[model samples]
Target: MHDVVIAGGGPVGLFLAGELALSGCSVLILERDRDLTSPLKALPFGMRGLNAGSAETFHRRGLLEAMLEASGADRKEVGADPDASEAPAPRDVSHFAGMGLDAGGIDASALPFRLPGPAMAGFMTSLEAVSTVLTRWAASLGVEIVRGAPVTAVTQDAGGVTATAGGQEHRGRWLVGCDGGRSAVRELVGFDFVGTDPLFTGYVAKVTFADPRQLPLGFNLTPTGMYLRTSFEGHLGMNDFDGGTFDRSQPLTREHLQAVLRRISGTDVTLTDVELASSFTDRAMQATRYRKGRVLLAGDAAHIHSPLGGQGLNLGIGDAVNLGWKLAATVHGTAPEGLLDTYTDERHPIGAAVLDWSRAQVATMKPGPNAPALRKLVLDLLSTPGGVTHVYRQTSGLFHRYDLGGEQPLIGLSAPDFRFQEGARLGELLRQGRGVLLDFGRDRALQTAAEGWAGRIHYAAGPVRNDLGFTALLIRPDGIVAWADDHADTEAFQRAATRWLGHPRTWAPQVGSGRVE
Candidate 1:
């Protein structure tokens, strides 16, 4: 038996394994892929997730530096560097001159912190980056990784959960399914995966750029009702994703490639090296049930959708960070198991929202007389300052906020990714396998309360980010402000903390785990 056994070693499962391992939980990951040690092999421009908030995850876990080292990517290096002399961000689409995506709101500059391990997300990088870094780092912290063992089913009771993997059974105090769209673990637990499936099949092919003039060095063709798109980078800095809907009966062939190049680039530039091409459909579904007995679902198992916003991959990984620590806290008997319930309560709605928006985008992309007009409206909004701000916030994942009620105003807001003058940035401290109290550099009572109960709760202080304002706050492991104190009201702050995390802040029974369950 293990403390936690995760099915599906995709981005979500890999991240969960790392979080659990880092939290000191004895965890094992069962991946169906043949190679256990291979880095995540992804297509050139596979947009992962689009949360500006994801930056917190990448920076906190030190994966930013990991990717920089692995792919030799410079943080300052972007497709559109105003100062680049030779290769530059793409400038135009077919008949659309200088058609470049304005990614001005994003902070492409590198911050401080050298990370103790490796980084994961980036185009031209591997999917295994997230898993490999977590696996190795988690193993160093004593987590185990098992590959090629696809989970066949799961059985659970109040005591624990047992999983059958490729004719073998593994028991654990709790089971987490990070498996992709079709989750065996979810099916075994009797959870209903109710959501929309793709009516059209899509293919993604990563072609090497031997010819520089094929397409401009920028984002997916400004989303103009033009031909298809070129390479688009996810806000997370993963792979470049480019490709579109394909006929279900027809396979992706050179003809399709020719047609795409002809429509967008106005050049019939043939490619010799097609590194990787994957054909899959969209599924905008979420499990009707997130937890059944001791078995729980996360990532793709919990939600799957059209990869329009680069959300599928990143959303799953985000679920890992959110659920892993909650489950570990529950198993350790610190917080109430109720905390785990929050995973579904919080993320399920987010999934639904993404599905709705993604479907709208796919609808807009439909080739028809109105398609051009629809695309024009979107681009017009995107060009405006308000539209640009909203677009970046929505697409970059920075605007993701939860309704988790806490006295701290920042509770639902993205945790302040402030620059730490003396120590590591506030974000880096969170990746230390524990929750961080933003402290906002105020309130002695929190220290007293935390000291009153040592080991279980931890605290750290940093000045608020210039954008966050002048107040002390406490952030959770998932980079959400669990509690914040605007003034020097220690008792009020402690009360808020108690309501948010449950004092002694454990997964104990009876007091509710901050969820409807």
Candidate 2:
């Protein structure tokens, strides 16, 4: 039997498969669509923002560089020296409910926990590019991906899971549903998907306009609805607040899109051709539990929300990364008691928060007098320093912290990308997909404590340029801090290691003079 049978070969499934395979677990991905390439996943419609968490996850896996290189995103133009005769480079900007905030207003210094690095807080990318990169990487790691195989049913007991897909049966020690929001595995598993419905139907399309000048350029917020026209040829988006009257089940037509454009933009814009069109709603939902017996849910199958702020893709990727290592450990028979359960405990709240974030955006964008006033208030707040920083931190996924029940603030937060004196970067250390016990002081006791978990945990001793108020940190496979302290506490360190990496399988004595065992 395979270690994991994942439903859906999208980015999330492929990412999780790569993670599992990196840890030497067998993974099989069953995708419903035979053709992976679709216009919906291309530019304009397919554009997705990669937040800090998602970007860092890729960096740790050594995939971010490849993706950036492939997309020609690595060759960024260097800013001209202001002291010289050249103009400074343009600053990067982020948005809140379509309200833009420049890099100047955001005070990165206020974020004391963020590590100094060249890694971006956020960047624009397309779903097609991300999926393409992940598919290749997963395959390289020996993951088997089967397309045109839709999962119809799933049966699970304490021993394993059996999935029926494309008139064939597949068995695995565990099953994960990474399918889209309309997840068949979720339905068959009887998961309690609970949440609010949509307030409007959103449309994204690429079309040729009969009279392009009739529509205004950029975003237009009207009394009835909102619309956006991009610089790209015939790329437009509209939000029709008709209590989601548009039928998403049917294929989108040119006539329907023209109607939506006219109503939302309040313009007599005629569409000559609709090259591509897709509709989405702000309907938010989340599975009550991420796991049921030997079956699990990740990505869109676990939670779904409006694409506002482009948080959906990042949230799904975070779920995959967080669940990957824990699930692999469970399947490898190296997990501690309750290790797998922590996946839901840590990720469920994040999903709920994203849903609420989406709801807040939709509420402000609703067509009403009150919504306009609220939008004005929000815009005013975003113009301020505190508001800009807070929103940036939240939307960029930099402020996400799991409640690991530790007094230390660093605990349960993403580890800063520390630059050590030995020229090793923290992100580089994580490329091996193993937990790390980073000791800045190079304490012998800490090294000795980590000796038993050598293979599962990598112990490193180095002096970092910036300590970020922590002398030591125990970073999990996903780069989350399971424990941190200003000073080394051997007993506490051992306890945290046991809790996260599990009790040492074999104890080994420290070798002479060498720091690590």
Candidate 3:
């Protein structure tokens, strides 16, 4: 039986697959779509722009920089140099600062969270770029990516999980459904998807050569939840650029898109060079349950939100990445059953929050009196140092903290970025392919305890700063802290590991001779 089989090959599924494969777990991924070569549409191409947090997550997962560099290198090879092309290279690969347009690189280290940005239209370049790197990375990690294997049915029992796809039957110790928003595996398993699909249909169009002069100052117009282009550059700065750009407050049609350009910018419009365009509704909702026995759901199958936050795709990927390692450990007989349960605990709350934010964004953009008031308030909030910092924090993905009951040091807290004297920094260390286990390397009690779990863990020496809250942290393969000391406790190490993480001996270590052993 395969250790784990993921139902989707989208970025999140691919990311999770990579994590599991790298951790030495045998992973099989079944993607319904036949075209494996086709770049996965990780986001709504016409109207999706990533925040800083998305960029940082890619970085932590060792994908952001690699993907950008790779895309640049590919462009150089293919003569599609982002710097030289009529169409810009995808966003992540393109240096936003160099291009004169960016999310106003404000430092947000001091902030608690990042508020999401107003919806804008940007190229689907970042997702594609990240996918390029992820494809290669996942392959390198030994994940068997099976395309056209539409998962038709999924069922789980006490022993393991069984799935049927493309008329083929497969068995695995666990099955993870990383399918898209409308998940087939979730349906097969009868998981109730709870949430409402909103009425606003996001009409997306990637029209090219739409004479630049014909547009208003803003490259993007948010007048009526409608717009053209990402954002305007050249002098208007960010918000002031596209004024007459299709009042986003109104229902948009293909004609509306064309007319807005011609009327505002005094330019003729035609769709000769149009590359891609489509429409999808903005629905803010999530699955009622993330898991039901050995069959589990991750990615879009678990939560589907409006495209406002650009959170849909990244959220899904993060979900899969978080779940993969835990499932893998369980499969390998190293993690406790409780470890698998934390996936829903940690992720559902984030989904609920996204839903709330998307609703606010939608309400703020509607065509009504509230629009102007909300617009001013939002702009005011976005422009403030505090507001900007909030946006930055959310975008950076650094603010995400797991619930460790205020007891586990690094377990619940995000390990802040730090410069290291050794070969790698904190991110680089965690990026080395698996979750890290930072051993004081000097504490005898800790060392002795670690020695017993030698086969599945890695050791590291940390004179790790004391206030970071974790001394002996057991970081999961997905870079989440599974266990850590609350206040540098030398003896609580084993209990911490067994309780939070899937440490081998989660059950009581049979009171050996009624002594501490």
Candidate 4:
């Protein structure tokens, strides 16, 4: 049996598979679709923006460059100078309802513990680009992917989980559902899904516009609804506040799309041909708990919201990285007690916050006498330096602080990429999928203490360009700072390490002998 059998082979599933495989766990991905390539996942329709947090995640995995290349984004546009001594100002910011925020208005002084790194800015990438890069990476790490195998059922017991997919049963020590919003594994596993219903039905289509000039480029908010026309020819999006009454399962006929667009845009825009189209709703929902016995859920399977603010994909990536290593350690018999449970504990709140964020956007865009006033007020607030900075913190994905019960500000935050005097970086050290113990003081006692968890944690001692007032730091495999110290405290380090990486092993038992010397 494989250590993990994941349902869905999308970006989140593939990324989780790679993380597990990197930690030496056997992983298998069951994908519902026979083909990975789809017109909907390419170019204009699939264009997605990767926030700084997601970019940093990719950088730690050493996949950032490939992702940029796949997305055809200039490296300089998405990253900061490598040799810079200080962090740079924010150059990118997310929008609210249709109102854009100025990156210049973001107060850089408010964001703490930042340093010059390659992934400081967010960039645009397509879903196909992200999927391609992750799929190749997962395959290289020996993850078995079985396409056209949709998960039909799941059963779990004390020993393992058995998932029925494509009429075949696959066994694994654990199971995770990385499937999209309408997830089969979640339903089969009896996870209680709950949330607010959608307020509107949204559409994205690639069509031939007979009267292209009818709708102008950029976001257009009308008294009734909102519609967007991009620079890409015939690429269109519309949000119709028809109480979300549109049947999404039915075919997206050109007539229906034309009617929606005309009504929302208040212009008789003609669609001669529709090359591709898809529909989604702001029907935000989330599983009450991410896990049930041996079965677990991540990404849209666990929680789903509207595509507003473009948080769905990035949120799933966060879930994958956060859960991957903890689940792997649990399967490998090296995880401390309660390690696996932290996945939901830490992620559930974040998921809830994203849902609310989506709901807020919908509220601001809903067709009503109050919507315009609300939108104007929000825009005014978002225009200020403090207001824009708040928005930046909320959406940037870089400022999230997991509740790790720490007094220090840096704890539970993504580690800053500290450059060593030797030109090495904290991000590079994390590429091996192991915890990093950085000792700026080079304390012999701390180094000796870290040896107890040698294979699980890598110890590196050096003088960095900037230490940020810390002499040492313990970063988890996922690149989260588990502990930070102003000085090298060996006992504190050991305790913190044990809390995350488990108790130290001073010796190993002889193979076949089953006994320690």
Candidate 5:
């Protein structure tokens, strides 16, 4: 039996597959679509933004640079030079609702905990570029991809999961549904998807306009609806708050799109041709639980929200990263009891927060008397340091912290990318997909204690210029700080190690003293 059978071959599934295979787990990806290329995943329609956490995840796996390079985005554009004397050049800033925040107003200095490094907090790329890079990477790691085979049914018991696709049956120890919002696996597994419904039907299309100047240059919020025009020729987006009226199953036509555009833009904008068109809604829903029995769900299968802030992709990718390692460990027979449950506990709240964030944007963008005041207040607030910082932190995914419960302040947070005295950075060490026991004191006893878990954890001793308030840190494979202490104690270190790595078969010396029995 395969170690994992993933439904859907999108970026999230491919990423999870690569992670599992990196740790020597067999993965098989079942994709519905045979052709990976599509116009909608190309220019303006395919554009997506990667938040801080997603970018860092890619960097930890040594794939960020390659993905960016393939997308034609300059490395310098994503991050600033640490040694630069002058202010770093500004890139495109993120928006909440339809109002954009000023890039210059953001004060990065306020975020002292954020490390200075080459990794970016946010960057824009197309879906095609992301899928191309991840597909290649996953394939290189020995992940098997079977396209044109959609998962029609799924059955699971304590033993394993069985998925039926294209008249064939596949069995695996675990199953993860990474399919899009409308997941067949989730439906077959009978997961409870509970949340609010859609408020509007949104449209994104690539059209050949007879007269483009009739529309506004950038995003235009009208009394009736909203519309956006990008730098790409004839790429347009329109939002019609018709209480979710338009039929999504029906194919979109040029006539229908032109009518919608003219009505929303309040212009005589004529469309000559529609090269590509698609529809989405504000319907937000999340599975009550991420896992049931031997079956699990990730990406859109677990939770889905409006694409207002472009957070859907980022959130789904986060779920894959968080679940991949724990699930792999479980299959490898090394996970502590209840370790798999932590995925739902940690990521559920994050998903709920994103849903609320999108809902808030929709509320503020509604065309009504109250919306004007709300928008004005939000814009005014975004202009200030406090306002800008809050919005930046929320949208950038930098504020994410797990509830790993520990005395140290950095516990449950992403480990700071500290530069070691020996010239290796924390991100560099994480590339191998192993937990790290970072020690700045060069405690020989600590190294000895970690030897029992030898291949599973790496022991490194190096001094950092800025320790970020901690002398040592125990980082997980996913780059989260499971344990941290201001001052090293033998007992404390032992407890932390046992909590994450499981109790060593044979105990070693104390953290700072002589060997023990």
Candidate 6:
């Protein structure tokens, strides 16, 4: 039996597999699709934006450089000067309902606990690039992936979980559904999926347009609906406000697509041929809970919303990162009490926020008499520096606080990429997937106390180029700031460490123990 059985071998599943393998847990991935290559996963249609949060996660995992190369993005564009004493200003902002925010308006000084690092900005990439990079990483870690195996049944008991895929039974100590929005594991596990329904039927297609000039490029909001045409030739998108009544399973024939485009654009734009097409709805929904006994869900299987803000992929990546380490710890029996449950506690609110964000975009773009007025009001507010900064903080995926109940403001947030004078960085330390305790004060007590958790929590002490006014900090394996203190309080540090990494103690490996010491 594998330590974990994952449904869906896409980015989330691959990433979680790698994380588990990094912790010496065996993982098996059952993918629904036999082939990874699909037109929708290539350029143009497959294009996705990796927010700074996602970038930082990859950096901590030592995969950022490869991801950038796979996406054909220049390192200079995505990274900042690593040697700089201070963090760089934010340089990227996401659009709100086609209304762009000026990166210049983002107040860098306002964001707390930020430090200069390689991944400072979000960049464009495709699903294929992300998958390629993650697949490579997961395979290098010895994760076994079985494609063309769609999960059909899942049964869990006191011991573990057994999943039926492709007419075969695979047993694992735990199971996670990383499958896409239409997830079989979630359904079979009896997770309650609840949320608002969709408002419109959206379409994306690659077509041969006879009269491309008839429809204007970029986002065009008409009295009836909205249509978008990007620089990619023949790439078309439309959002038809038909109460989301269109049956998505129906064939997207050229005639139907042309009619919808013409109606939304209010122009007789001709689609000579539709080479490819897919339909989606703003049907926002989320599983009530992330885990059900031995079975769990992450990525789109846990929650789903419209792709309006380009947050779906990034959100899933966050889920994988947040859950990966905790699950691994649980499987290893080294996790603190309730550690596995915190996955839902810390992430559910974030997922809820993303869903509401998507719904807000759809509301602003919905065809109605009040839409123009609402859009105008929103645009006016977004024009201000404060408004722009708020949007950046919300959308950049960097500023979320997980409510870890620490007094310091930085607690419950991602740790700053603190760099030691020796040129080591927090990001590099996290590549091993273990808790990190940085003793900036180099106090003997703190160092001695951290030794109890030796192998489980890596401890380092030294002067950093910038300590950000902290003498010490405890960072979780996922890079979250579990605790930070301006003074080297050994008692506080121990408490924080014990809360997250379990009580510090040395373990001697016994024969056939199947445990890491």
The best candidate in terms of lDDT: 4
Please count the clashing residue pairs in each candidate, in the order shown: 43, 0, 22, 0, 0, 0
Task: Give the range where candidate 3 is weakest over 10 consecutive residues by summed lDDT.
Answer: 508-517
- State which candidate, 4 or 5, has the greater TM-score: 4
lDDT of each: 0.59, 0.82, 0.58, 0.90, 0.81, 0.89
Q: What TM-score, over all chains together, does every model reach? A: 0.78, 0.93, 0.76, 0.97, 0.94, 0.97
Candidate 1 accuracy as TM-score: 0.78
Sorted by lDDT (best first), the order is 4, 6, 2, 5, 1, 3
Model 2, residue 6: C-alpha shift (Å)? 0.5
Tens digits of lDDT, candidate 4, 376-477: 999999899999999999999998999998799999999999989999889888887889999998999999999999778889998999999999999999
Expressed as tens digits, the lDDT of each residue in 1-517 for candidate 3 is: 8888889887778888777775677889898988755422433352234443444445456665465464343323222232221222222321211112234434334542122211111223445655657777777766788889999877789988999998998898888888887889888988888776464545455555445555453334344333445452311111112322322556544565455444433457554443444445556668777888888888788877666656676577667667766776776677766788788888888777777766666556555546667667676666655666555445434456778564544456455443233434445555544555675434666766766555455556656432243455666556666666534455566665566445554222111110000
Determine the backbone clash count of candidate 6: 0
Model 1 off-target regions past 4 Å? Answer: 37-51, 77-100, 104-125, 206-276, 406-408, 419-421, 440-443, 461-471, 505-517
lDDT of 2 at 365: 82
lDDT of 1 by residue, 1-517 (tens): 8989888776677678777776667887788876755312533443332243454476677666554445445555312232322222221111111123465532332211112111211233456444555555555666577777988877788778888887799999988888877788877778887866565455556554446465555434323223333444211111112332453456656566445555555566665555455555554677876888788888878887766656676677677778877887777777644788888888887778777867766665555567667778876766665555454455545457789775544567666455444545666676555666656665576677665434444566555334244455656767776666555466765665565456764331221111100
Give residue 243's lDDT in candidate 4 (0 to 100): 69
Better of 2 and 6 by lDDT: 6
TM-score of 2: 0.93
State the number of backbone clashes in model 3. 22
Instruction: State the lDDT at 306 in candidate 6.
Output: 88
- Per-residue lDDT value at 307 in model 4: 91
lDDT string, candidate 5, 170-252, tens digits: 99999999998999999999999999987888999888999888886677888878999988888888888877779486679
lDDT of 3 at 435: 50
Better of 1 and 5 by TM-score: 5
Which run of 10 residues does model 6 get worst, by summed lDDT? Answer: 508-517
Cα deviation of 282, candidate 4, in Å: 0.1
Model 5 lDDT on a 0 to 1 scale: 0.81
